[model samples]
Target: MNLIDFLFLVFATLAVGGGLLMIFSRHPVSAAMFMIISMVSVAGLFVLLESFFLAILQVLVYAGAVMVLFLFIIMLLDVGPEGSKSSKIKLLSGLAGVVCFGILMVFSLILVLNSYPECSSCAVWPTLDDNNLVLGQSLVFSTSVKSFGFGLFSKYMLPIQVAGFLLLAAMVGVIILSKKFVREGNPS
Candidate 1:
């Protein structure tokens, strides 16, 4: 196999393995660390895909900044190891998860078997030709930082702003929920 293929395999394995480990990990700190590992591996995959700008952002934003924030939250909340679930509960959840996954896989397989050009509307993607409006424009597919920034600010501004507001709201909710209220002059 080629070096690129080998690297892709390595990165993909790390990404999946880290994700599984993160999900199954009992300790919050360990789970967070595993998530960072998965994020870094995903960044490597992005690098392989030749999207350097996205790769860097994935590393800087997800693996570094976001992970630090998550770790901070975990520590601040003083989270401890998870308690074990009962066997019946675990069995039911596992069965439900497997059934859901099977349904999703079948749905995806049907989509793949049925449609390609039929999936997207003729207006949005008329043809696979390079001369097509969406495909012709570098703005849609370019990996350069300038193009990304321009597109994000101009075309995708409102959704981005909304997402930011949602994240802020979640943060506020977390802070409010975790707030320790000291009752005035109440002693045990």
Candidate 2:
């Protein structure tokens, strides 16, 4: 009805449509492009929701880093068009997917019907409100972020270090897997 509502609907439709295209596209590059489009649309939605931090994080983390990794794999692996082919077990996979989606939809519908919040006539984001200030303070100096930092340093430090090492190992593994190696018994 209103301009903001129209923009929200357009962004939402673009996000969902692009996500579906990403899921079903046969070409890896085309799927990646669709995924980027979806991520951008979702970022736009986050902006509409007045969550600027979340919007930036979504673009930086998902669109910039994760998508770079995905595209790198798609390109560096030299995966042909045939690489996107579905296996013979498609029917079973499709049935499982449909069942999972049905269950999820039922749960979501129940949640929406039973426990949905009442919409207030007040603007969603009032300017310079106490709640907004509190949210900002929490994000900047929260116990949660401090706890996360401590956990990184103490409890999960070794695992974090090992994860870095494992990533390095994976890079090595990828190189080894992609290389043409000759066995002792095989002709070069």
* Residues 15-65 of candidate 2: C-alpha lDDT, one tens digit per residue: 999999989888889999999999999999988876666688899999999
Per-model C-alpha RMSD? 5.4, 5.9
lDDT accuracy of residue 98 in candidate 1: 90
Deviation of model 2 at 134, angstroms: 3.5
Question: What lDDT is obtained when candidate 1 is compared to the true structure?
Answer: 0.85
- Estimate TM-scores for all models: 0.72, 0.65
lDDT of 1 by residue, 48-112 (tens): 87778999989999998999999988989999998988999999999999999899999999998
Task: State which candidate has the highest lDDT.
Answer: 1
How many times do residue backbones clash in model 2? 0
